[model samples]
Target: MFFRSSKINEFRLWGLLFTLAGMGLMILGTSGIVFWGQAGKIFAGIFMVIGMIAMLISVGVYFWAGMMSTSATMLTCPECSRQTKMLGKTDRCMYCKTILTLDPGQATQHPADTTQT
Candidate 1:
C-alpha cells in the first residue's frame, strides 16, 4: 500500500529518474573544469563515464517495461469506468487509483465497501 502506482507506471517513473540523474551527472562532469582548473579534466572524464552507464541502465529499464506493458491485461476499471492495464492478479486503476482484482475469491468484499456504525 505504500506504493500504489501501477507496475508499468512504477517502472517508467524509475526509468525517468535514472535518465534525469544521468543528465545531471553529465552536466556536473563538464562543469568540473570550472571548479578545479587543469586537474578537473580527470574528474570530468570519470563522471561522464558513470553518467553514460546510468543512461544505459535507464534505456534497459524502459525497454523491459515496454515489453511487460504489451503483455499486461487491459481491463475497464469498475470505479472509474476507464480502461486500465493490470500487471498481475490485482492492480490499481491508472487514472483513478482504485484497487482492482481479477480473482473472484478475493472479490467478496472490497476495501472501500466497509460499513461503519
Candidate 2:
C-alpha cells in the first residue's frame, strides 16, 4: 500500500512536471524566432515538436490514472476510522498508514469488513 501510494504520487508529480516543462518549451519556441535569428527558428521547431509530444504523453498518463482510480475499492480504515480507497492485491487506507491486504491467507490481511457507515 505504501508502495502504491508512492507510485501514484510519483506519477502525479511527473505528470505535473512534464506539463510545466512542455508549456515552457512551447513559449520559448514561439518567442525564440522573434528574439534570435534563423538558428532560433530551427531550435524553435524542434522544441515545439518535443513539447507537444510531452504534453500528449501527460494527457495519456492522466487518463490512465483516472481509470485506475475508478477501479479501486473504497474502504474505511481500521486504524484511523476514515474513509479511503484501495487497489490491487494490497493497499493502504488513504487517511491512515494502516497496511491493508485483500488476501485472506496472509497474516497481515484485514477483512473487507466495513461498508459505508
Candidate 3:
C-alpha cells in the first residue's frame, strides 16, 4: 500500500462542508437578504453563480476522494498495531503517529518518497 485512506475521507468531509455552504449561500441569495434595490438582484445573481461553482467543485472533490479511497490499501500499523489505510508510498500511523511504509524496497528510498500522504 502507498498511504492512509482517512485522507480521502478528509477530502470527502471538506466536499460536504463546501456543498452545504454553497447551498446556504444559494438560499441566502434567493432570499435577497443582502439588499432590496436592483443592486441586490445583481448581488443575488453573483451569489448564485458563486454558489453553483462551489457546489460543482465539491462534487469534483467528492469524486476524487471516492477514487482515492478505492485505491488505498488497508494494513496494520506496526507501531500502533492497529488497522489503518495508506495512500501513497509512505504514511504515519494514524493512531500512534509512527511513520510507516508498506514497501520494504522503499525503506532506503530517496527522501522525496518519504513524504506522508
- Best candidate, TM-score: 1
lDDT of 2 by residue, 1-117 (tens): 224453354456678878998999989898888888887899899889989998988888777767777777777777888877676766666655577766777646555867888
In the range 64-105, model 3's lDDT, one tens digit per residue, is: 987887788888987668987777877666577666677778
Runs of candidate 3 with Cα error greater than 4 angstroms are 1-6, 27-34, 105-117
- Best candidate according to lDDT: 1
Q: Over the stretch 1-117, how does candidate 1's per-residue lDDT look in tens digits?
A: 446878788899889989999999999998998999999999999999999999999999999999999999999998889999998888788888888889977775755756787
Worst 10 residues of 3 by lDDT: 1-10
For model 3, what is the error of residue 86's alpha carbon versus the real structure, in angstroms, after optimal superposition?
Answer: 0.8
| Ranking 1 against 3 by lDDT, winner | 1
Q: Roughly what TM-score does model 1 have, to 2 decimal places?
A: 0.87
Q: What is the TM-score of each candidate against the true structure?
A: 0.87, 0.71, 0.64
Error of 1 at 32 (Å): 0.6
